[model samples]
Target: MKPFTKLVILLLSITFFVSCGNADDDVNFRLNTGDGLGKGKEVDECLNLGENDLILSIQEQFTTLPGKVSILFKVSDSDQNPISGLTADQFTIYEQGRNDDCFNTISTSESLARISPNSQVFSNNTLLVLDLSNSVLSSSLTELKSASISFIDNVMPDTAQESFKMAIYWFDGENELHLLNDLTISKEELTMAINGITDDISNDPSTDLYGAVIKSTDRATELLNASTQGDKIGAASVVLFTDGTDQASRFTKDAAQKKVDEADPNISFFTIGLGGEIDTQVLTDIGKTFSVFAANKEELETTFNEISTRVSERANSFYLFEYCSPKRDGSGENNLAIQVKAGSKQGAVQTKFDATGFTGGCE
Candidate 1:
């Protein structure tokens, strides 16, 4: 065969194999193209490239795409009732990425209410890293169960479009990574998985808090890369429930904390120190690695409730406003001012925004 002819055939064969192989692994590269002006049904459907576009040397800037925005939240109200039927215009979001107006502004309320058309991954994955070592199991178990049920029942509403992808792991004896269920909104399934856990069940024959926490999130890091969204997760976070002691494990508490921090700065590690035996120093360091979190049991439940509520609020609400030009003499980063505008004719531009920098980014 002539060299040119042989090369042509070889290229064709490789292309053919890649096109039809392992559909699941086909990372949702599908670029959604439209005028960005909210158009017809076609605009709402995520686009899968066609043979015609392929030949045109079409390039999709999804990775370098600066406008992509993402946030994971549930729904609730001041009284904590599940708020339903939100619209895209009701909320606002401001985005900032490293080293880059890499900033983005868009109305996500509609996307939040319904499933985002552009996103292939449905569930926003969450890891509930628990400490089940016998050392602190008795006191923390009950609270953990209550929190787990509340999390499954309320925070993660079982729906076909969106839900929390959750896993429950603990270190009771040896390392116990209980059930790492794939992202699903099945209330029954989640409840069963969370409550079915028995500290008695061990991944090994001995105690393993550090082992379980470290390993669970390590696995989660890999999973979140293609986290349900079928894309790389920018802010994958964790809701850690632990007493914060490392009596048994292949890794130490410091090692686990370092790993998690480097894995995802957005991984919010919220700990629940159930008893005095709970190691506050270790957990505090863990939580501090991500964001400011409570350190004691009295504060633990409050923190859990607060964290859950904030996440839901983020889901249900939106921030709406015109971008203000940054000051010429000031630093590139400008502190934004946001007010509820609950009532018209509110006094001077009230400074409603706080150090947390809205959306609970924790400044």
Candidate 2:
């Protein structure tokens, strides 16, 4: 064959292989083409996607209107570690009850929700409540500060988006929760607040651990409630650290426990105790979500790191999956499932969404 003809043939062969590979990977759909392909009825009706990523967990699912549903979920590895950097192409949404036995795949272009590269989707608020009692200041103040700074560094990303914020509060003998720093996304600011802690920051050195729990939980609950009322999704993490028991007795233990129990589930509570001075049972009850104890000051950082990992993972794990549903009110309730594929690994989850109020056509 002529050299030019040979080159042309090679190019054509490459293009054909590439096209086949893409079709094997994903079925791309043009959402608004107004053609039969864009009308949501052209793709394969397969019920399964072979294998799926099993580490995904769905937390909440709700529909704002007809033909649209939003899901809040988390993705983790086999060891239950949060997985990040996933994109919309890695997922295939299927709906069964809306149509026939075959599952219809929601187009990637129609997926409005995705795992953000930044922390935008995960609007997280964290509160660090410290007990600045004399007992803690006299013995392990430096260790506490170091451990706290480590936690802030681990949890707070380098570039602060509007989605993530942190605040610091210190409690002495008083029943009040003194604010060391207001909510801010700056790691430097949070570190500065921790470093600024000194023995003289509070006039009374007695620990009001119970009061701190009550006040911090209340504050977290308020933040979460405000976010919800404002039509935004938000989560809060409250980490309380103490080296001794509640000495002020300004608030009863039962009151503090009740406050925590009554707090919103969106707010996660974490407690850290140093030495034997702290009541493990009390801290555990207060930190029903998670609790850690350090035998001494040297182990504070390790304990704090464990809690920080959990909080940060939980904060960052949230993934929002939004898609256009084919079902209308007449469809009643439908069976929905999501399968995630990342590289060669796969996971799947099944959930149901109501089409009771589904009205206008899906966007």
Candidate 3:
């Protein structure tokens, strides 16, 4: 090869490598300013926290009368697993005004920062669909009831909140999806409804698994639509438990899978299967978010618990962080950064808020 040709090839290779590296860095460091909620825009002048272990995706942010700023966001680890139970003390608020060279940390105590309830603007619903066909009713009714009660205890909060609720439903060979209990925040009500299921509850001997999937997806869609009225944002989870495949064949597998694939992104699908008769592939496909299996009835409770942890974490990851800003009127637009620390891992997100109207009293 000629020396000129070799030199040209080396230059091209360097250019290609540098371009790829730049693209990767853009994706790795860019923060996500969420859509579909409130006013959250990208801040080009904001500081880059650079390769943190946590991600805080700001969904909605707004300033209320009298200088209170509220930001709603979801917290997750770098691996995308939700981080729940973070208190206001874990957060450090920093603000930079037009006159300041750098951001100044605001004292949490003086600012009266708090993690308030998000019920006014956010809602989370879970639909627990159970398979009570003749096989499960006669063989695993006792175990199913126990597992369901444990699920309710683990998923429901100790104190009831209007924003969080769960509903129970069951399916058999029949063409209908029977409602065991309506959506409610009370765990006792859900537990009682599950405990009341008897062997005679399901008259059909076959399973209409596909039909249940389609119907439950429809129900979750309705719940999400209803919850998202006015300025509220909502999310739903459809959890299905089955012991066998679609024996009735009333609905085609393709139809069921398409429903799940085309469903809203905010809605998550989860499936729990028991015994050897269940099809792992179908369940895994239907439960795109997560899936768990139990080889026997004895392991039913454990599988339910595993799913419970995920559902709870997803619901608790969202936070309504509110604080009083020190910047009065004429500050115009200022940069704000929120830093969260969980053990050794820490992450920060930066955005801007306008303080057009000055205020003194903020609660």
Candidate 4:
């Protein structure tokens, strides 16, 4: 028989067999036609896949279960715009050992990332420390309250994650560091706490700015430590507002600055200074992450709002990605490479994880 006639017969026979299979069978099949040159292949060779230009920025990753790994990442195009509308099938995972130079692709069925949208697994905490000394109260008490309320409104979104919380604190010349409100997720509670601040609330007229800084940093450190031990990721931001120098001098400048420097790297520090009496150099040194200054009471609201905007953006940018691992318990340490494709754009990122407990089969 001629070659064309034989090919026709073979195709017909295969179609007949598939049509006659049992209806309850769960198996699926596909036919791959050869390239024009007759080199049988599943992919088309004529299509052009230009240079890969996507950005897969992986922020944080962890192993949540015996065989599952979770990653927090962001996807952006070459122009830096966030890439959306991507499905789980668009990702390909490859695995290799520490000593291997080549990566072997894991099966799409076994190692695909189950992309969860807008899932914030990490915890975020914010400490708002205010100076309630005579200097600030006599000059800008009303303005201060307005700014504080605005900051709370901006930071706490309508659909905030359960892990997001904020605390309010105030300090004066007296050694006591008053807690206006403990860490909470309720906007109403925070607003009520800010409204309660008044000139008569402070017993001393002096400003113990240094003491407040030390206490606030210590509180943030404790939170971070507790969360880590509880197997939860924790991030804290300490924003202190002051309008004058440390007049009480209860704690030395060196002691206060040392506490900030020794703080956990995960905790961010932001300082807002109002009026000309504030020591710009000292506030700048204290605000390790960010600092803003207001010439007078009029600018206080704007300064607080600026800091609030930045914090909100950072919180929303994070993501969580999880996948099952092909490695078994005794596979030792291995490397992971993830590739993403959207339209014709593509990019890749690599990370390493220890497989000491990577056992069991995924469901």
Candidate 4 regions with alpha-carbon error over 4 angstroms: 1-67, 72-94, 97-101, 104-121, 316-318, 324-334, 338-349, 353-363
Which tens-of-lDDT digit does each residue in 1-363 have in candidate 2?
Answer: 999999999999999999998876543332111111111122233663554334666655678775678776767665444566577778888877845777766676754545433343346899999888888888888999999999999999888767788999988898689999999989999998898887777888788888899889989988777655544567899999998898888889999999987777567889999998889999999987689999989999999999998888877766777776767787877877777777778777776778888877655
Task: Please give the lDDT score at residue 250 for candidate 4.
Answer: 87
Shift in Å, residue 223, candidate 2: 0.8
| Candidate 2: Cα lDDT at 321 | 70
Clashing pairs in 2: 52-346, 52-347, 53-346, 53-347, 54-347
Local accuracy of candidate 4 as per-residue lDDT tens digits, 1-363? 999999999999998888778432422221001001011111211222344476666656777557887776656565544465567788877778755666777776667567764334567789999999998889899999999999999998676556678899999998878899998889899999999887799889999999999999999998777655544566788999999999988899999999997777567788999998999989999996689999989999999999887666545434466788878787787877777787878866677777887778653
Considering TM-score, which of the candidate structures 1 and 4 is the better prediction for this target? 4
RMSD (Cα, Å) for all candidates, in order, is 18.5, 18.9, 5.2, 21.3
Off by over 4 Å in 2: 1-70, 75-90, 96-99, 106-114, 117-122, 322-336, 341-363
Stretches > 4 Å off in candidate 3: 1-48
Reference-based lDDT, each prediction: 0.44, 0.78, 0.90, 0.76
lDDT of 1 at 113: 24
After best superposition, candidate 1 residue 67: deviation in angstroms?
17
Candidate 1, 1-363: lDDT as tens digits: 999999999999998888777553443222122111011111111122111110011111111111122222222322323333444444433323223233334234422322233233233556666665554454456666667677655566456334355555555555446654555656777678767766665444445656665776676676656653434222244666655456565677778777755655334455555555556767666654233244444455566676666444433322112222212221223222111112221111111111112221110
Give per-model TM-scores.
Answer: 0.51, 0.70, 0.87, 0.68
Off by over 4 Å in 1: 1-87, 90-123, 136-140, 158-163, 180-182, 202-207, 228-235, 289-303, 311-363
Q: Which stretch of 10 consecutive residues in model 3 shows the poorest summed lDDT?
A: 30-39
